[model samples]
Target: MEAEYDVAVVGAGPAGATAALVLARSGFRVALIESTRYERSRPGETLPPPARMLLARLGVWDAFSTLGSLPSHGNRSIWGGPEIAESSFIFHPYGEGWHVDRQRFDAMLASTAADAGAEVLYGMSVVDCSAPDADRWHIGLRGESGEAGTMAARAIVDATGRTARIARRLGATRQLADHLVGAAVHYAGPLREDGFTLVEAASSGWWYSAPVPPDRLVVMFMSDADIHRSLRLTEGDRWEHLLAEAPHTMERVEGCRPIAQPAFFAAVSHRLRRNGARGCWLACGDAAIGVDPLSSSGIVRAIRTGEGAGQAIGNWLLGRTDVAGAYERILDAEFEEYMAERSGYYALETRWPHSTFWNRRRTIDAAMRQQP
Candidate 1:
């Protein structure tokens, strides 16, 4: 017989892990499925300071804090102007932010979920999900050793990052504003700028460089997918040529040797038409709304949405109603606020009015304005 769960949360990142942890704590049998085993590299390692309270609320704060994550004091950027600028996190109630080891951070979340009583299935791929009726979701799974299994759940939460794999399988279409990609390269050297992150803009795109931990920094170029392909960033000379366009960024990366081949990440700024409320399922994290890296809200947002979904789903499973309504209202408000701020920020980069990258940003804003 197939295993059954009150909720089967897919993609055990921040959102899924939190969802599982919460559900398990609420006395529900939850199954958390994750494809990656967190053995390799992934991006989006930075988290704002406010996330501490969220982790604390979820009861995983002490474990996460003990991971020796690098503390980030603030950010120094040349964004919106030629001269460099600084924004300190000290103003926030929470002291310093963190640039975490993303792989380990994710592992910690998964481990915590398992300890909390959720069946944390790592290195497992969810092949598909079917809703035979209002009663349950039948999920197909494949194990790491090429073994196959099936599980049933009363509810599903798609926290699969921007992929929205499970939600899309159920007919949800992603709404996109622009095509964005991040090409990153890890660098190892002396900690040149200890506590502050760096952002510098160029004619084609922007650059983000931040110290991760111990003795390493990760620098990445942000641009549209087509633009990145056009520039042939895979080639060292071409990558360095565009990188040098930002003199300030060049200075930060100085003396740092590239420790890995350039890595690419999908940074597309987007959201879904309506987050999953169909057949007792909800989408969280980037699966629900994918914002740009410029906001630096990805991890925090993921954890927040996970908590909200967990609570809302818990309420519904226990005989409460309109969980989806509350979930939708909260996420919609966040999306609107983020879009407004994004528009204002992009408008500040008028220096690159003729640049293809800037043009795309403007076009996206103009389209949003035309929306009814």
Candidate 2:
């Protein structure tokens, strides 16, 4: 016999865990599925101070505060200029941000969801989803050992990040704006007490370095796909050459040894062509809309969207027909605001006015402005 649930959330990141936690707390039978066992390194480890409120709302503030995450006090940037600029969070409403171990943080969220009565399944992947009727969805799951299982759900939540696995399988098309990628490497060295994230802009792209909790430092070079390939940024010699260009970032990682080879990942800004709501299914987090890493809002946005999607789904299940439309409107407004802010930020960097990387941003910004 297949187990049944009121909601099945695929992908146990912040978004899926959050949605499962919310629904479970509301007395819904929720299933949170994760493909990984949280043993590997993941990106988006920086959490801004504003996320404190969201954590509190999720009832995990105490746990998070005591999670041994490193506190970040401010940021140092050389964007749009040759001189470094400092922005401190000392006066902000929330005292300090955090640099967390993504695996631990995500695991904490999944554990909390389980504690809240949600059935948390790790090391499982959703292989197929089919709806025999509009009221229920049948999900097929495969374990790490190739063990097969089945479950039925009244609704589904797609929290699969930028891939939008479940939503795409349901016919939602992703509308990508740019093909930005982040080539990141972690270094192990004596910990620097300074908790500031450093950002330096270059002719080709940008560089950022920050201390990963405990004793590791993470440094990444951000650029377009073509730029990354043409410059051979992944090669040892070429990567070091580019790093030398950003004195500030290079200095931060000095005397450190790379723990592993640079890993490349997509950091593109995109959204679904149609709002990710179809019958009893909806999408949240990067699965619905993804923003550029420059915004530093990835994790926070995931939590927000997850909470909203949970509430909206709960309402829809309780016979509220208007929640989907309302949620779609909220997503639309948020994306528009993000696009406007992103354009303004990119416009500030005129140091390499004719560079392909910078010019591409300018062209995209211009087209966005012309959009009705």
Candidate 3:
């Protein structure tokens, strides 16, 4: 016999876990499925001050505070010119931001969802999802050990990150604005007392470095796919050469040593063509709309979208048919605002106007303005 749930959330990252947490707290039978056992290191660890309110709303503020995450006071960056600038969060109503261990942070969210009555299923992948009618869904799951099972649900939530797996499988298309990629590497060292993130812009792209909890530093190079390939940035030696371009960033990690092999990830700005709602399922977080990491709002946006998606799905199940449309509209508006802000940031860097990376951004901005 297949277990049944009011909602099945595929992917237990912050968004999915948050949605599950909200629904479970509302007395819904929810299942939060995750592909891994939470052993892998994920990115997007910077949590801005705004997340404080979101965490409190999710009832995990106390738990998150005890996670040993480091506090970030502000950002120091060299963008748009050769001079360095510092932005402080002192006047912000919420206080300091945080730099957390993504693995632990995500695990904490899932555990909290479980504690709130959502069935947290780890080490499972949703291989197939089908709908028998407009109101019911059947999802096929496979375990890490090859075990198979099925679960029925009244609705589905796609929180599969930038891939939009579930929504794409349901016929939605991904509309990409750029092909940005991040080549990141971590270094282990003694904790540095400085709590501000560092950003340095270069002719090719940009560089950012931030201190993680305990004893590590994360540095990444953000560039277009072609730029990354042309420079062979994935090669350790090439990566180091590029790092030298950002003198300030290089100086900050003078004593640190690489802790692991370098990793390249997709950092493109994109959104689903239909805004990720098809029939009984809706998407949230990066799955519905992924923005550039430069925004520094990835996790915050994920939590907000997750909370919104949970509310929308709950309303739909309770006879509110307009929630999906409303959700789509909200996402569309947010994406537009993000695009404008991203363009404004990119416009600030004009030193390398002829650089392919910068040129592409300018061209994209122009195209966006011409859009009706």
Candidate with the greatest lDDT versus the true structure = 3
lDDT of each residue in 66-147, candidate 2, tens digit only: 7789998988899998998999999989888999989889999999999999999999999999997889999999999999
Worst 10 residues of 3 by lDDT: 271-280
Task: Show pairs that collide, candidate 1.
Answer: none
lDDT of 3 by residue, 215-258 (tens): 78899999999888898865658878888999999888888788
Which should have the higher lDDT, number 2 or number 3? Answer: 3
Clashing residue pairs in candidate 3 (N, C-alpha, C atoms within 3 angstroms): none
Query: Quick one: RMSD of model 1?
Result: 1.4
Instruction: Tell how far residue 45 is off in model 3, in angstroms.
Output: 1.2
CA lDDT, candidate 3, residue 14 = 92
Tell how far residue 315 is off in model 3, in angstroms.
0.5
Assess every candidate by TM-score.
0.97, 0.97, 0.97
Stretches off by above 4 angstroms in model 3 are: 275-277
Please give the lDDT score at residue 348 for candidate 3: 91
